[model samples]
Target chain A: MPVISYIDAVTQALQEEMQRDEKVFVLGEDVGVRGGVFRATDGLYKEFGAERVIDTPLTESAIAGVAIGASVYGMRPVAEMQFADFIMPAYNQIVSEAAKMRYRSNNTWYCPLVIRAPYGGGVHGALYHSQSVEKLFAGVPGLKIVMPSTPYDVKGLLKSAIRDEDPVLFLEHKRCYRLIKGEVPTEDYTVPIGEAEVKREGDDVTVISYGLTLHFALKAAEELEKEGISVHVLDLRTIIPLDKEAILEATVKTGKVLIVHEDNLTGGFGGEVSALISENAFFELDAPIRRLAGPDVPAMPYSPPLEKEFMLNPEKVKTAIRELAEF
Target chain B: MGSEESVMETSRHEALGLSDDQVLEMYRTMLLARKIDERMWLLNRAGKIPFVISCQGQEATQVGAAFALDREKDWLCPYYRDLGMMLVFGQTAKDQMLSAFARAEEPNSAGRQMPGHYGDKRFRVISGSSPVTTQLLHAVGVALAGKMEKKDFVSLTSFGEGSSNQGDFHEGLNFAGVHNLPVIFMCENNKYAISVPIEKQLAGGSVAARGQGYGMPGISVDGNDPLEVYEAVRDAAARARKGEGPTLIEATAYRLVPHSSDDDDRTYREMGEVEEARKKDSLVQFKKYLEDVGILSTESGAELEREIGHIVDEATEYAEQAPYPDPSETYTHVYAE
Candidate 1:
């Protein structure tokens, strides 16, 4: 086992996949030569050269369309949108073209495409930089939404998404890029696309979260461990085609469920998780299902205080779980 | 009575060394496309089909472009109204009917998408959807792959004058130009996008003029003349194979019928205008060329017409009788099984 940062793990997966399969290539603005704006694709251009590591123009739709085209023509394309918010211009291609390709073609054509974007708040990255597009993309069928909280999950899931027969949206929390580090094996491995992991196991209350919020939930569970209360932190690694069975299992075990996310509460992934739990495992729940999410606003603001208010702190998660238990 | 000389064809299709038989084959494909489009409309009226987007007056432009490409090696990303190009690219009359009928046997989509959304992998026809110009981007991407792999294949994508106004079209052509990819962008400027004419759609007044900005050679041809279109696309395909770059071709044709069976052309344009355009119909022009070349006669033309009608009849019957896809199949392809 080796400790690597979340960004490093993504780089490793891309490097390994490209080395193993020549068909796999990367294309986006500032990806080649620049090694990506965040250096997520560092050293790839040097290792693979300009041909495989293509530098595209500033057209997001073309970038996505090229990926769809290349994917259909026996090539695996990993396209990058500089930021999650900027992906709006390319959404028509991803959701309309790439997502519906297989179904529209009766499975005669498949787009083995992966669109990677850095999402979520907490780094004080204003409106354009700190948005989470997973909730927007999760509504689209034929697309897998993979949001990893740790380096190990990022490495494993990025590799799996590359080899998937269909399209996938790989969202990496920008705050977790260099902050989160974990042990990843040197041997070949993959994290299955539609599975969830319980980061910390407990009995009293189950807190379901993903991306950076999962870490908050884990910290809350740890702080509560010092007390007599036990809390289970369920990390939903893949949001779309959500690990329903894992959610039901956590519901059955804890009986007190709390779903949390950094996205606004109105139509967040937490809403879907809560709906599933209430629909499938309602009788098993001891109390009403709870959610701790960002308030309904346009986006994460630039001011630190406003941003902090928008984000769910570990202490807040702790308080929410305590209230759930009291109920 | 000494000797009667039939009007010799001085057309470019003949000058390009296409024998009368080859030219007649082109005519046959164009005729097949027109007949299939006509039949689909009939079905829509009879309540057997739901929609129809016709390639009525653009046969010469589409068939001629497909004729110039390497049928086995080159790829096509045809728009919704590309029945002529599909027929030339090996999509059969039955294939079009299956799609129109939206049955289980439909090769492109198994009763999932609407009619005119065409795609078949075997013919190298890239799948297309209803979004105006998305296929243009896909064609460029496929060409970029071929360029990277050093393949001899060229990708030809077609769209309307209206679609050329889409951002996808600009992005695709610009990207193709930057990379010097093996792509041929064919704009079938059919005078109208639904009801809006070219005057309202284009500011430059010429679609080909925009090609200079993308650094590719752009040419406009008479869509009513198949030979002129064949020459233009043939040259573009050659340039693509030589790795020179992409070429933009504006093939101006008329939309003989309404946009679809659902549209009422009388509300926007007069029947007098359609009748005026019908005199320059490519189908009639190409048939005259075949007759003048001494390869076809009144009797042979009528015979081919009968043969085409029978094929359409059989395809319609088979497709109409075919079953709709199972209800469970709706969820199957949404993700990998």
Candidate 2:
């Protein structure tokens, strides 16, 4: 076991994949010489040549379209958008071309590619730098979505996404890129996509979260433990083929559910989870499902207090859990 | 005709490398395309197919350009009105009929899309999107891949004069120019974006001029002249194989038919305007050239016409007899796995 940060795990996955497959290559803005703005691809360009680790122009649509074309012609391309917000220009390619390639072609062509982008807020990154585009992309079929909050999961999921037969949106929370560290394996390993991990199991209530919000759920579970409220924490690593069974099973046992995420409370992934439980596992529930999420605004200000106020902190999760416990 | 025919005159003899047999073949295919347009119009009138875009006057441009490429090796990403090109290529008449009928056996779209949205992965022909210039970017991508893989394949992508105004078109040309990708961008300038003519939609004098800023060769060709278009595309494809960059070619053709079966040209333009276009018909010009060279007689042209009419009729019967797939077939081709 080796202690590694989330960014290092991403780099490890890229290095290993590129070494394993000759078709595997990286292309993005500032990814070749600069090694990415967040240092997620540091030391990769030096190891690989300019052909494999390419620095493209500031055109996200070209990056996405080229990745798809290369993938169609028997190459595994891993494209990167500097920020999730900048992916808007490439959304047409992602949704129209990449997502529909397999379906429209009747699966004769599959876009085996990965698009990596740093998402979420709380890092003083202005409005344009932070966003959660998973929901927007989730509506598209033939695409997988991955959001890992820890170093080990990042390495495993990134590797899995690269080898996937379909396109994947690999979102690395910019807030958790350096803050989270875990013991990641040096040997090759891949955590399966579309599976949820039970970070902390408890019998009282379940707290479902993903990405940066998973840390807050765990912290809230710790705080609630002092108040004699045991909380089960589940980390939804992938969002598209979301672990609906795990969610229903966990909510059935705990009898109370609380979904947390960094995205806005309105029309968040939490709503999908809450709707699933309410639809399928309503008979087993002991209390109403609740969602603790960020404020319904574009993004928060850079000031410490404003950022703190905008984020779903541990205390808020604890309060929500206590209130649900009384129900 | 000797080599001194650059002034665009009607010559007695046929051009070199263009036999009367080839000219008749092109004419028959164009006639078939016109017939398909007429059938689609009748179908729309009788409440069958929702829409139909006719490629009547620009048949020479499509057929001649398609004749330049090897269908098995090269790729084509054609816009909506390229039935003539598809016929000239290896796409079977039954394939076109099935697509037009929107049947499960439709080799192009499989009932998932409309009639004109053609695509065949085996032939390396990608489906055209409804969006105007986005497919131009896709064409660049395909060409870039071909170049990177060292494949001797040239990608030919077609669009309308209206699509040239899109930003994606400029971006695609810019990328192709910078990377020197193997792509031939053909602009089928039919003079009208539905109702608004070229003068209102386009700002530049000619669409080919935009390629000059991207450091690529931009040339204007006589769309009605089949030999001229064939020569231009042949040269472009050869240059692409030699690692030269993209070329923008604007073929100023006419929309002899109404914009679509739904549109009525009587409201916007005069009948004299269409009669003027019919005067410069490619079929009549090529036929006279072939007759002058002794390669074609009036009887031979009539016989060829009768043969193509029989083929189109047989293809229609085959499509009509080919049973429409059951509803359950809808879920079959959605995913391979």
Candidate 3:
């Protein structure tokens, strides 16, 4: 095992996948000789020719549409959107074409493509660069949405996403790319799409989180353990087909639930997860499901204090968990 | 004669083929397309079909360009009013009728889409959208993939002249030019985008002029002449195969009908202009040119029309008898996984 940053894990996964399958190619702005804005695709163009690691024009819609067309014609394309915020321009291609191709064509077609976009806050990237819009795609049927918080999971989940027989929105948290470094296996492995990993198990309360906020929940769980209030932390790697068993079982064991995410609180993906628990295991809950999320503001800001104030952290997660555990 | 005059004459007669049979075949397909529209119009009026955008006057341009394409390999992204092109590209009259009637057996959409939304992935006809210029980029995308894969396939995208005003038109062509992709952007300059006439929508006065900015060759053709459209597309396809990048082709044609079955044309255009455009009807021009070239005998033209009308009638019978898609199908094909 080698220690790798989350961004390097993404590059490694792409490089390995390209080497393993000749049909896999990467295209995005600055992905070729320039090696991507975040260096997630560094050395790919040099290792494989420019054809395999392509740098496309600035048009996000073209990049998405080209990937879709190529995927339909026997090639797996991984398109990067520089930042998740820029993906709005290509939303039509994602929502209309990629999401509907399987159903509209009556299972005769599949968009075996991956759209990799770095999202979320904490890097002072201001408004346009930091957004967690994975919630927007959670309800889309054909698209599998993945948000990995650690280097190891990013590598494994990315491989699974590329090999999956459907279109996937592989959203990487830009803020966690370099901040989180961990040991990742060099061998090819796949983290199942809809499974949740228990980062830290306890009996006091169950804390469910994903993407960048998973770290905060875990930290909160560890800190709360010192206060004798043990927290069971669940990291939902894939948001679309959520691991219902893990959620139900965790809520039943702890009898309390607290959902955390980096996206804004209202209409975030946490609402769906909370709703699922309420519908499935309502009587098991000792208290109402609590959700601690980023302030309902328009993403992150450049000002340090404003950015920090709007961001979800371990303190907020701990406070929410403490309140829930007492119930 | 001056060089420009000779060139114009040659360009105008570009439709003139070496033999009579070629002209007759072109005229036959145009006749087939015309009859299909006639049948579709009748169906809508009789309440058998919901709506139709009759490709009455623009048959020559659609048929000619489709004939120039390699139906087996080349891809086509046709707009809603391209029933004529759809027929030429192997879309059976039965399949068209099934789609027009919103039946399950329609291969284009399997009853998932409205009529004229042509989409068959197996045939390389990328699904079309109602958005005017969106399909232009999809064409460029297919062309880009074709170039990258080193495949011997060219993508032909057909859109109205008004689509040139869209950013997608500019972006698609610019990308194709920048990458030297094998694509042909065919602008069916039907003189209007609904009520907005050419002058009101376009400041450059001609759609072909927009192509000059992209560094690709641009050609203006008499869209009413099937031979000219065929020659222009053939030349453009050859250029694409030779790695000469994309070409912007403006087919100057006329729209003799309203925008769609739901539209009223009297609100938009002057009756005089509509009358003037009717004189340049593509079918009429092709028929007259066939007669002038001795390709169309009076009996042969009537015989072709009768045969096409029978085919349309048989297809309508089949479509009318075919059942609508089961309601359960609505939830089935939304996703493969």
The prediction achieving the highest lDDT against the true structure is 1
Weakest ten-residue segment in model 3 chain A by summed lDDT: A101-110
Candidate 2, residues B220-305: lDDT per residue as tens digits?
99898777888889889999999997999999888888887778888888899989988887777766766665567889878877
Better of 1 and 3 by DockQ: 1
Task: Please give, for residues B182-214, the per-residue lDDT of candidate 1 as tens digits.
Answer: 999999999999999899999989999889999
Ranking 1 against 2 by lDDT, winner: 1
Q: How close to the true structure is residue B1 of candidate 3, measured as C-alpha lDDT? A: 84
lDDT values for all models: 0.91, 0.82, 0.85
Number of the candidate with higher lDDT, 1 or 3: 1
Every prediction: chain A TM-score: 0.99, 0.98, 0.98
**What residue pairs clash in candidate 2, if any at all?**
none
lDDT of 3 by residue, B1-337 (tens): 8644463444234444435665567677778777777788888989988988767778889988988888899998788878878877777888888988989898877888778888886677877666677778778877877877889889999999889998778878887888898999999988889989999989979888888998898899989878788889999999999999999999988888888899899998888988988888877777886676556778988888888888989999999999988998888855453
- Cα deviation of B323 in candidate 2 (Å)? 3.0
Candidate ordering by DockQ (highest first): 1, 3, 2
After superposition, candidate 2 runs with Cα above 4 Å error: B1-24, B265-267, B332-336
Candidates' chain B TM-scores in the order shown: 0.96, 0.91, 0.93
